[model samples]
Target: MAKQYDVLIRLLMLGDSGVGKTSMLCKFTEEGFNSTHIPTIGIDFKMKTLMVDDKKIRIQIWDTAGQERYDTITKQYFRRAQGIMLVYDITSEISFRHISKWLDMIDEGAGSVARILVANKSDASALRIISKEEGQTFAREKNLAFVEGSAFSGDNLDEAFEGLVKIVMDRNKKDIDEQLQSIKLYGSRENSTIDAEVKPGGCCS
Candidate 1:
């Protein structure tokens, strides 16, 4: 069978319970939203294929349960992730406050993985406790990409994934380039004939 995509990127979503991690993912991948709050029991994933820079990129987004009990299971996914979405509900101050703790966890396990701070439920303007400026300030401080949107209205929802994929792809390119440069340097040094004494038993024979 032919390969479906040129690149496979794995993304993980994390936040306190009720922060709309699953909803945000559903809106982005399925273009559907459900208002009823059903807590994810553990970790679940959804797949979406997008054409990024003319490359078929398949994104596997892993949605993790936000409850503390599931932290162990969720942390296990961090090392495998290419990007992580640290989601928080704009309407819930407690959830927003917990973003730092989530960041700490990402630092501990994900180790420089591309990350985006997502302020969800922007449609709930009446109940919004976290302002867009606040989210932007925090993101800037942490050098993280930020997006404020609502899964219900699908506003700016795609930006979260698009931005993350860009970061991941850029990092991947840099790594590949560095590897090639190192190989080129090694080849140049190896081919240099300076101070060489011919051993007749080897390739010189």
Candidate 2:
């Protein structure tokens, strides 16, 4: 039987508690959001399949517990992630401030994973403290893709995940191309060496 998906990507959600990481994941995967926020435990994952440019992609989004007590457990998931959403709540300045700390976590645990800075709760414009410019500026400074949207309204959620997927896929393609090129070069070099060592005749000659 054929595989269910052409590509499999593991994405991780990292943010402080109450930043709407779980809501964002649920909204993207389940197409619904709960107004009542229930804190995630150590870790939980949701799977969603999407098609990008004719390739079926299976995304496994892991939501990590934001509370400090679960920090150790959350760190273990980072290494395996192909992409990460560093989420923050627009209404909460503290949450926005914590994004840098989350970046530190990514640097330490995630290495070079594709990342996007997600500012959630855009529907709460009245309560929002972090301006769009600030989010964009920070994302630029950190070299991360940025998207500000609402899990409640479902704005830009699809773009956020799809953009990250595109980044990962492009990186994967580039890496594969580089490996193939290297293999071809090595083969050429080995063939040249063999031809040079072999005299104009048989091995016995």
Q: Which candidate has the top score in lDDT?
A: 1
Backbone clashes, each candidate:
0, 0
lDDT of 2 by residue, 144-186 (tens): 9999898889999999989988888887887645644664555
Q: Write candidate 1's Cα lDDT for 41-156 as tens digits.
A: 77777778898888667788888889999999888889988899999999899998899999999999988998999999899999888899999999999999999988889898
TM-scores of the candidates in the order shown? 0.84, 0.84
Measured with C-alpha atoms, the lDDT of residue 48 in candidate 1 is: 87
Error of 1 at 71 (Å): 0.7
User: How big is the positional error of residue 109 in model 1, measured in Å on the Cα after superposition?
Assistant: 0.9
Misplaced by over 4 Å in model 2 are: 174-205
